[model samples]
Target: MSVRDPNPLDSRHPKRVAIVLSSPAISTTTGWPVGFWWSELTHPWLAFRERGYEVVLYSPAGGRCEADSLSDPRDPSRYSDTDLISLGFLSTPKLAALVEATRPVSELSVDGFDAIVVAGGQAPMFTFEKATELQRLFVAFFEAGKVAAALCHGVALLRYARLSSGEALVKGRTVTGFANIEEDFADQAVWEMGALTRGTHLMPWRIEDEMRALGANYVQAGLWRDFAVRDGNLITGQQNFSGAATARLVIEALGG
Candidate 1:
């Protein structure tokens, strides 16, 4: 894919995008190390790059980010063998380097990009939740009229990201994230593996429950389906599978 130049005068300048990922964190409930989902990052990246958009990877804490092992297609556990998109992305040394050393969110200038995409995994439940800097950065991009997108657990960041007016960013907008049914399936899978108790939760709160409580019109498709919703400049995907769809929406929003 050809990278777009950022200069507006150049005619060939491509729109710029910032993809924020969570730094490595251990799931307190399941005691598993997690960061970003491989497909959540790679699929959207492929979509954006294919459209000739320039993308940069970022993290709240910077440095290398870990991928949730279950999201890895080559993982011996075979949970994601069908994820050929992520597999192809992982095999590309140049493209794979983007996740290995990410710039911290603090170093990014919101005005420099046309859009922002936040990728989620098990770690967002711990790291992205209540992240003031991330909240501000997302709000800045949103308030600037830039396309702001999030998928799966990454949407949890919207729970506390308030506008300068002190209102929740998702208050009246439509959005979607990892659904309750999907989470239940994941929990059951963990339980079957003896990694969690039957009644224990992988996350403290459900994304749907929280989004509803905040007054956002939270929508979901069938469990594990590739669902994405766009409300003007804000776009959200239902789960890891919806990444590319979500990215395409962002591209369309940017007038690509």
Candidate 2:
């Protein structure tokens, strides 16, 4: 992807976007960085900004956030290379500015945004498991008929989200997220390091399984490839690598 100019371009009509953060910080168990997965946040932010959308970053519990080091291009884990659009955004002052001033979920008004993106990392499972505020934000976005998306563990929120009629928002809608195999690979790495990797943080139950239980149309592309699925206004990307693809899908769904 080509790096674009960062001139102060404004949206024709500000299309507000609310991105939810997972604040649990990674575990020493996996030796991953202590924070959000880079691409899941950065890639989509870049895509939205490039298209002239106003992006807002927020955490479940507001504070300074961190990005996974392994997801950073500068990490030693580059041995297993990833084409991270995030790295590109991270280097830009305009994009980094958003991350610098992210607000808390409590401060976000769901109706003010055109769409909501739930970002993931190893931390989400721990942080978002029973987070009612985060769940409410997602539910509000879906209820308002705005584009709602989640990548990787962020998809876990969909498991708890319901419609106004008390039905699963994802019921009968196709969705995808980090698969069991990918989780296995991550957990194995931590085990090899002789660290205690928590099964809950890894692939406890595949998104497909829970989606099946919710009567969602669940699909998984080949592992670690850039893939995303759009089911009505709910767009879901499988993993970190799928962030950019998912963001474009959001723009397309929003009629950008």
lDDT of 1 by residue, 30-107 (tens): 777888999999899888887778889999999999999999999999989999999999899997888889999999
lDDT of 1: 0.89
Candidate 2 lDDT by residue in tens digits, 1-256:
9787544445567678888877756453444446678878878887887888888889887877777667777678793245456667767787777766678899989768889999987677656766888888798888788888999878988888988899998898899988777877767776676655445244445566787899988888887888899988899999988988999899888877
Best candidate, lDDT: 1
RMSD of 1: 3.8
Instruction: List the lowest-lDDT window of 10 residues for candidate 2.
Output: 196-205
Residue pairs with colliding backbones in model 1 are none
**Scored by CA lDDT, what does every candidate get?**
0.89, 0.79
Q: Which ranges in model 1 have alpha carbons more than 4 Å from their true place?
A: 1-11
TM-score of each prediction: 0.94, 0.85
Candidate 2 TM-score, C-alpha based:
0.85
